[model samples]
Every structure is written in structure tokens, then in C-alpha cells.
Target: MENYSKAVNLLTDADVIIVLAGNKMAKLEGLDLLGKGQFEQDFPKFAQKYDVHSIGDAFDQQISSWSEKWLFWSQLIEQYTNHYQPSEAMMNLLKIIGKKKYFVATSIFGHFFEQAGFNENRIFSVFGDWTLMRCSSGINHGTKDDRQVVQAFLAASKKGQNLADLVPQCSVCGQPMELNLPLNDHFYPDTDANTRFRWFLTGNEEENLVFLELGVDETSPQLFEPVIRLVQQFEPWHLIAADYPQADFPLDIQSKSAGLDADTATLIEQLDKNRDF
Candidate 1:
């Protein structure tokens, strides 16, 4: 209860909120890449052929053909993202942030923040979003919306049509296109969004900002040390980590930070309940 009060107070008094989300938040939003929940049952083909039991394993495997790869990719994307609904915790998070100046830096690439109505400019998807595709030729061919291609594949699949010809190609390089994910060395991060996120950080260096760590775990090493260092540098800055314990934080920022040691949903729910807005 004391921890919840501290978290709520930090949020309420904050002039700006910076949300850092990771794999566990992805799991809450129905895209658990590491877990084996229904992976074999739903994707029996990949399961039987590659012995891949989870989305992570499936992505790590090199499918025999581009046609097979895109078909499987489309199915996974459509299954996880096509009908995505913001979970209760997401909604509660919005209420907690209620008109506050905020920016989101997330490694979850499911387009959840955009779908949940966050300003697109304020979000930096650090891992890149799967809904977009880029050239596979190891060149910076730029990204394009692949929702249409996904839909086309799904439609054709319903009619039992082959999806070989439907595989999207790069218009500039005439090479096959792959998801805008960090699947290989060719994956590119969103530079424009990255710049914006950096600008937001520099712009609010002195403000009473709250860095809300939601489900950030070891999988996203990018979000961990840098954030802690930032908090240590900025005296006015406070950290409210949902998954980390208070003892885990450095001694320097311990007075100004709260490590709730709870799941994202529980922390957000508590904040929502305790907040005045």
C-alpha cells in the first residue's frame, strides 16, 4: 500500500511521463513470443516441420522458402495483431497518464500504442514494428505498410490459393521484403522516431519527469542500464519500476525512485485506483 501511494504520488506530481515497456508488456497484450501457449496447436505446420514450439523459435528458424515464410509470418501477424484489443492495464495506464505530457519507448512491436490511440509521434518502437516491411537485400530500402499484403495473403489462403506470387518485393531493389523486425543483421531501427525520443529526453532534462518502467526485463537490455543512468544523473527525475524491487535500484536514486516489484497490470491498476484523475 505504501509503495502504491508513492507510485501514484510520483505520477501525479510528474510534469512529464516517459514509459519504457518490454517483453512482459508484450505478453500482457497477447503476444508472448517466448511462451509455448498454443504455439504447436495453432501453428502445427511450423511445429511439425521445424520443431519450433514458440514464436521466438519459429522466427529463429529459417523456413525453406520465401512463400512458406511469408505465409507463416502473415498468419502470426494476423493472429496476434489483426484483432488486438488494448488490455485493461493499457486502458488504466492511459487514465494514469491523463493529459500529462508523455512519450513511450517500447520494445513491443505489435503496434499496440498506436492502436490504443497514443500519438504516433510520441512513440519510439525501439525494436521496429512487424506491421511494416523492408527490403531483405541488406540495403536501406525503407519500410512500407504490409497490412495489405498480410490481408491479401489471408484472403488468398481462405480460398486455398498459393501465396508465392503474393510475396511483397522491394520496388527500389527488386528484392524480397521481410518484416521490419530485428530478425537479422539487416534490420533497421526507426531513425525518425529514435530522434524524436532523444529530443524528448533532452527537452525535459530538468522537468519533474517520471520514468515508468513497465515489464522491462533482461530481454530488453537497451532499456535497463541507460534508464538507470539517466535517473541517477537527473535529480528531479524519478523512476517507478513495476517489475524491479527497490533494492535493485542504485543507492543514489533510491530516495527518488519506487520499485513496486509487481506485474505491469497490478501496478497500473493500483495507480489507476489511487490517482485523482
Candidate 2:
């Protein structure tokens, strides 16, 4: 609680609270941020591969056979980072929140931003979202997104093929589909598709913004580095961290090392109360 004062003071006026949570947090709260309902669909042998025992060992021992690491992480799940999300208690704490930019960027498919109700411009997830599925073929023939298409993709995966390629073909052109994520050499973003629909949203960097981090270990500090640099420029911006008993606060910026476990509900609640979140 060394600099809780600065963090609390800044949060009082923050326009947005960017959340960096992971799949573990999503699963704990009974939310579908990772599109868990379609987990097995996208990854055919997902559950069978990571059974209860193996999964427990992986997390407990940090041991992954070279094969499991590559096959499961490489071709199957393409991600550039490693992170575990915050629990539902964290989510409930955030849902009551509204303000600046709640960028929910996560290594696990990066849906935390949208999950917390932030706009595309405000939030950015490096890993693409499962909410969107691309076809392997091409834009026209490969996009089998609806329930029926996911089912077909699952069936195709069972036979040993990519879900993106398995999507039902385009009726007219008749071609394969691909997942929306940047799968191979040729991939592009849809300019016309706007999830915002039509809403007036705007913000300035000078405005209050809190990089509220919870349960985020030091494994991958890249995501927080940008904000850390920004604090040097805009000293008023808040960089609050609620890590476990073992976390080490940076020497420069102020941080709170609450050694308590991940529940974080009590600590966050306390911070919010003192800070007026």
C-alpha cells in the first residue's frame, strides 16, 4: 500500500479502467469470454488432450512436454503471450464500473475488453477473438460462423483437418472458409463490419485513466510496459497493481503488494472504497 494514495486519487477521475484478465478468471466466473461453449469446437481434441490430471500438473509443475507445448500452442492455439485471467469477483467489481477506456486485452483470445463493454477504438486485444471465426477458403466461401457451421467444423476436425478449412462452402462460389484470425499468408480485416453499430465515443490521453492490474504476475511485462512509460510522461496517470504476496513492486512507480491470494475481491473493494471507483 505504499502508493495507494496516488492510485486512489487518480482513479477518482479516470475516464476508463483498462482490464487485463485471462481465461482462468473467465472460467471461474461462469462467463464465456473465451467462447468456452465453442472451446472443443475450435479445438477438436482440446479436452481429451488437456485432461484434468495433465492440466493440473502443467499449472502446478510448469512442465509441458515439447510436443504438448508445440502442438497445443503452435498450430492449434496461436497466441503471442502468456496470462491467466482474473476471477468473477473481479468481473463483478468491474461491471459496476463505467468510465474512460476499459481495454480488456488478454493473451487468451483477447476478448476481455469487449467483455467489459469497451469500444474497438478504446480496447485492443493482440490475439484475435473467437467471437469471430474465419473460413480457410476465402472471405466468400469460407465463413461458416453460425451454429450449424461450427458443428460442421467440429466434425471435420474429428477427421483430422483445420476448423477454418472445414467451414461449409459458399453456396454460390463454393470455396473453403477460414477463421477470422490471421491464420496464414493472406489475411485482412473487414472495413465494413462495425460492432459499435453507431455510437459517439471519444477520449483524450490527458484525461484520468487507471491501468488497474490484478493477479497479473511478472511472467510477461510487455503489456504493462507501455503504461509504465506513459506514467513518466503523464505522471498523474495511475498504475495500480494488486498482485499476490510474492509480487515485487517496481522501484519507480508506486504499487501495492497484497500477498493475499487471487480472490482480490476484498482488496479491490477496499481500494475502490478509499479511491471512489
Candidate 3:
């Protein structure tokens, strides 16, 4: 835990905090897509019909009707995103960042950062958020907030109302709309957010910044090496990872990086302790 002190010092001295969060962070907040224990219990019909035993498998299996699809999506979005509460770790992260210029690049698509009070413009959800939907026509028709759709379906399902007509469709091409996830080849990312992330890096190229990697693993491989490359490229940009050991980094940048080999919650908890807010 000696490095916990190092992390605190970095946070205190940094002008910018760049968060690279991944699925392990999502798991800490209770949205485990690959979890085997809860899928059948939470979604019996999906288990029975498709023999899918996890959320990942359920999303992979095609539902026979749009009604089923939308209903399933509604339940998931409501549980994970719409009704999400910030975890203690998230609050601690906010406190550590402390109004400093920060940008989040995360593969967690549950709207956790935004719901936790991070500015939407500074966060990029790389895998796409389920709270947003897009046209399924393999063409970019823009994204829409799917909160209204989720609410409508939740209300109808409670009353046993028909959901066929309730399924959202593209306003332009009239095709069925789907969650803004990279579930298929047709998935389109939030370009505006991507642009903003790029701009943040460019603008802060020479500033004292900490690139904090939280619970990143193979699920979000894109976040790892590229960030290390950035640390190698920029002298003022230090790297910190919750799950990676400090010795794992390249020899040259190892002095500027700290790999804690800990989980997100533990790191944030450590960062939160004995810190002035």
C-alpha cells in the first residue's frame, strides 16, 4: 500500500485525470455481463428458450419477436443504467479528481460515470451505452436517448400490454432500432465523444496528467497499450493501473508509471482515505 501514497500524490499534483475504465470496473458496480449465477434466475425465459446462461449469451441469442427483444432490453437498461446509483469507489474517484480537468474513456456502457455526476461531454463510452439506441440499418442515422423507450416498455410490461408497437424504429429509414452497443458490424460509436477525447489529449499533451487505468483487462485491450504508448511519448503523463503491476510496464516508462495490481474499488478506497476534499 506504499504506492497508495504515490497515487495520492499524483492525483494531488496532476492538472488532469484521464480514466481508462473497463469491464472489471463494471463488475465492481454489479453489472457483470459474463456472470453465470444470475442470468437464469433473473431471466428465466431467455434461459429456457435460448439455453443462454449469461447476459452476454442472452444478448447474443436472437429473440424471436421485437416484443421480446424490447422487453428484455427495457428490463436490463432499467436495472443497470436508468436506476444505477454511484458506488463508493465512484464517489471517491470524483473526490480525487476534484474538479480538475478529467476525461473518461471506458468500455462500461451502463451510463455509470454520467449518473455518478461526471460531465457527459468529458466521458467516452467506447462499447456504447444501452441507454442510447441507434438505427439498425448498418448506416449511421445518429443516436437517441433510449430512456423514454425504456420507460414506456417498463410501464407496458407491468400492465401486460402488447409490446410489438412499442418497439422503437428508426425515424429516418423505418428499420428497427437497437441498443447503441457494438454488438454487430453495424454498430456505430458516439463520434462526438470520441472527438472530444482526442481533443482532450491534444490540449493536455504537455500538462501534468495522470492516466489512471481501472480494472482494465482483455475485454478492453484497446485501453492498455495505447495509453502506455502515450506515457512513453509524453514526459509529464504518468500511468497508473489498478490491475497491472508496476514491473509489467516497459523499462523506460516504468519510472513514470505505477501498476498497483489491485482492483478499482480498493484503489479508490485507498485514494479516498486521509485525503482533504
Best by TM-score: 1
For 1-277, candidate 3 gives per-residue lDDT tens digits of 7777777777777899999999999988789999988878888877888899988998888888887898999999888887788888988898889879999999999999999999999999999999899998999999999999999999999998988999999999999999889889988888899999999999999899999999899988998879888888999999878999888899998777778899999888887895555
Quote each prediction's TM-score.
0.98, 0.53, 0.97
Residue 223 in model 1: shift from native, Å? 0.8
| Clash numbers, per candidate | 0, 19, 0
lDDT of each: 0.91, 0.46, 0.89
What are the runs in model 3 whose C-alpha is more than 4 Å off? 274-277
Model 1 residue pairs with clashes: none
Q: Which segments of model 1 are wrong by more than 4 Å?
A: none
- List where candidate 2 sits over 4 angstroms from the true fold: 1-6, 22-24, 27-91, 110-121, 135-148, 151-166, 169-175, 178-203, 215-220, 244-251, 255-267, 272-277
Query: What is the lDDT, from 0 to 100, of the residue 254 in candidate 2?
Result: 43
Error of 1 at 4 (Å): 1.4
Instruction: Give candidate 2's TM-score.
Output: 0.53
Q: Deviation in angstroms for 84 in model 3?
A: 1.1
Show the lowest summed lDDT stretch of 10 residues, model 3: 268-277
TM-score of predicted structure 3: 0.97
Q: Lowest summed lDDT over 10 consecutive residues: which window, candidate 2?
A: 193-202
